[model samples]
Target: MEPSVFTRIVRGELPAAKVYEDEHTIAFMDAGQVNPGHVIVATKRQVETVMELDDELAAAVFRTAARVARAVDRAYQPEGITLLQANKPAGWQTVPHFHIHVLPRHEDDGVTLGWPRKNPTLEELSVLARRIEVKD
Candidate 1:
């Protein structure tokens, strides 16, 4: 398989405005900034989706994201912040690598994310939850 765009960036095959990096993750400014402080924090291992990540790698990526979020807050001082992580194409994941978007939000930034509510009953929710509940 060809390398994902993020893999190319991490390997220095492409250019990115990198902000932070550690052993397991790397962060850089998003090419299409939703806001001034928009950034992307991705796993170094290029696992495509969050479900493919081992616990350690998953934790590392989120840790780096939070760290970057703090930096963005200090730098941009936006009224709000949003950390977004998506999965497959159906879930709005354009890039196939595991990454989180740190967005500095203002009152009317033109970004809108909305979904219809199902409003299932507690019994319905419990039934759905049981299908995927983790068991030790």
Candidate 2:
């Protein structure tokens, strides 16, 4: 399969403002950032979504994300951080390859995640928790 743009960046085929890179993944600053210190962590593989990521790979990517988030926190010291990884187009995933965005958030940054809170009943929460527990 042809490598993705992110994979090319990982393989050193393309130049990036690289912050970190490893055998499995790479982290760099976003070219068109919504805020300052916006970083992207991507896998060397061309997995299109988080669901396609294997457990070990997912964990590694998240670990890289956490490290980059900590750095963003130290350098930018924004109000908070937003870790976002969209899937398909329905999930606002523009890139076909999988990647996580470590957005350094500030007050009124206009990068709303739009995750509305749902006050589920206790029974619903219990059922959902049980379902998740069953997966382990």
Candidate 3:
């Protein structure tokens, strides 16, 4: 597999404010942080999302993210933490690789994740759920 920005960081191909690294994933400080102690955890492989990842790889990445988040929490002591992983362009995935953003939340921080809520009727929900449940 070709190297990603994350893979490069793991291999020291690129310079990053890295905090954690393991065989499967790497966690680094986000240069453009929305809040203090913001971090990004990413896999060395190029899978774009959880659905694209095998179970073992996905578990590894998630575990790395959790560990990083715990440390960030202890270090920064933010009121909360937000873990975000978007898939594909339509879902606002900027990179073609998998990553989990660990955003430390603070009341004074300007970061906001807002979307207009749309509640579907029970019948609509049932139809959508059934359609999604039918795996190939």
Candidate 4:
């Protein structure tokens, strides 16, 4: 597969306004900020989706995102905050790399995070849950 935009950034081929960095992850200001303080925290490894992340890498990514979110809260003082992560295009993920979006929110930020809600029957939900259940 072709390299993702984020992969290019990680390889030092593309420039980014990076905010935070560690051995396993990097947090950078998003080029398209929904709000001024919107940022993206991405794993250093080129994991394509959340399911591909091992526990350690996943925890590292979230740890960086949490730290960045707290700092954004202090600096921007927005009314609220939003943490978004997408797995596939169907899940609203444009980039193929695994990353987390930290957005500072206000009442009229012009961002709509709504999706159609579905009401499933108990039997339906139970069946689906069992199908995806993880076992030790």
- Write the residue-wise lDDT of candidate 4 on 24-120 in tens digits: 9999999999899999999988888999988899899999999999999999999999999998899988999999999999998788878788999
- Residues 19-83 of candidate 2 have per-residue lDDT tens digits of 88887788998998999999999997889998788898999999999999999999999999999
C-alpha lDDT values of all predictions: 0.94, 0.89, 0.85, 0.92
Whose lDDT is greatest here?
1
Query: Clashes in candidate 2: how many?
Result: 0
Candidate 1, residues 7-125, lDDT tens digits: the string is 99999999999999999999999999988989999998889898888889988999999999999999999999999999999999999999999999999899899999999999999
The candidate maximizing TM-score is: 1
lDDT of 3 by residue, 7-125 (tens): 67767888999888888888899878888799999998777667888878988999999999899999999999999999988898877789999998988678777899889999998
TM-score of each: 0.97, 0.85, 0.90, 0.92
Q: Give the higher-TM-score candidate: 3 or 4.
A: 4
Ranking by lDDT: 1, 4, 2, 3
Off by more than 4 A, model 1: none
User: TM-score for model 3?
Assistant: 0.90
Q: Which wins on lDDT, candidate 1 or candidate 4?
A: 1
Alpha carbon deviation, residue 91, candidate 4 (Å)? 1.0
Worst ten in a row by lDDT for model 4 = 127-136
